[model samples]
Target: MPKDQVLGPDAIAARLADLPGWREADGWIIRTYRTHSWKGTLMVINAVGHLAEAAWHHPDLTASYAWVEVRLTTHSAKGLTEKDFALAKKIEDVVGWQPGLEGGALEGTPSDPRFAYIKHDR
Candidate 1:
């Protein structure tokens, strides 16, 4: 329950089950998001930055022309903790959300390849 408590392997694995593309690697929970181009990659990074800043729990992100890998670990705890999992869940929810599929006013970006952004996983 405490933020400083380190999670064991089992706890990490259990938490990762709810996160589709996230995994427990070494001492962090990580996920790599595939983007359509450099622009999409920057968008993902910026979104993650805002979330991390708001939560006050930053993550290490590796970005490329087409992908961004998010790695979260609780620095204060020196290992995986609730902070890592919480931020990871928030990142996943925000990054993977598709308002268009919900059929609301926001019809999301065009599905066409010419205007597509992040390649949402099925």
Candidate 2:
């Protein structure tokens, strides 16, 4: 594909093959990063925002106590573009992400059954 051009379905699929946790969804490429705590989740979100701003390509982000879902699309191009993929790659790098690293569905499960976990001193 040409530099910074909007990618079609085939090209998007090919590019997505290399992006482990990302998937095509409703005209955007999306991924959810799971963290062990709210603090970790916020850390990831803020890092993404910084990277997006630095790259001049922002993504839609949704955050919860332990997870943040990122949806990337080029609003100017009206579809996916190389910029989105580039930003995703940068975010993945700084976040130290691995596919399913948070253990999938069992992720964020508290060690204590009471769900009243305490933070440890740093």
Candidate 3:
């Protein structure tokens, strides 16, 4: 597929396979990140906001006290495109990172439920 081509359902489905927890709906690829508290919810929203700005591809987000719903599409292209998929991947990586699991110097959020932020999918 061309770099900027608007993707059809089949192409979108194929691309979505590489991105778990994301799905197509009404011409947009969407995902909901579940957080444990209002603070976590705000953190997700802000993280996504920074990522979108950096990529220059914005995504619609709906939030509650415990969850954030992210909707991505190429508005200028009038459909799902590479931009959407790219941004989705970035969002997933930043929002779902677990440093402790990566065997790095940085320890992730504590194991105690009280310290847990995002409800990571298992």
Candidate 4:
């Protein structure tokens, strides 16, 4: 759906149910993952790069030696929208994490805590 189609809380909640390890704050959807090392972290970033390119929707990301933080926001919409949720879902799908899996989910807090903010015509 188009980003302009603003979604209410209920709709957003429903969509989020399908995606775990993600949460909404302010006007963005955020997720964080842990990698094995710097190399693994880059792998995740590169993987996400392809997904973002394919979707034409990019996320705000930060990386460390073994951690990556991804935050999604619909710049065109000026607030949360289906696009953000869609991108978040794609991230989860593409870079899947299985509990107890070797690469498992990222642990610890995010290094950066900021969302990509796009100015809108008000």
RMSD of each: 0.9, 7.6, 1.0, 10.4
TM values, all candidates: 0.96, 0.76, 0.95, 0.74
RMSD of 1: 0.9
lDDT of 4 by residue, 8-118 (tens): 888888988887778888877887777656766787799889999999998999988877889888888777888888888888866774333344565523333332111
Name the runs in model 1 displaced over 4 angstroms: none
Flag clash pairs in model 3.
Answer: none
Instruction: Give the number of the best model, judged by lDDT.
Output: 3
- Number of colliding residue pairs in model 4: 1
Higher-ranked by lDDT: 3 or 4? 3
lDDT of each: 0.92, 0.78, 0.93, 0.73
- Give the runs in model 2 whose Cα sits over 4 Å from its true position: 1-4, 97-122
Q: Which is the leading candidate under TM-score?
A: 1
Q: Give candidate 4's root-mean-square deviation (CA, Å).
A: 10.4
lDDT of 1 by residue, 1-122 (tens): 79879999888889888888998878988899999999899999999999999999899999999999999998888899999999999998899989899999999988888787799996
Error of 1 at 16 (Å): 0.6
Candidate 3 overall Cα lDDT vs. reference?
0.93
The sequence of per-residue lDDT tens digits that candidate 2 reaches over residues 1-122 is 66567888899899899888889987799988877678777878888989998988889999889788899998988889888888888887767643234577645535563442222221
Candidate with the larger lDDT of 1 and 4: 1
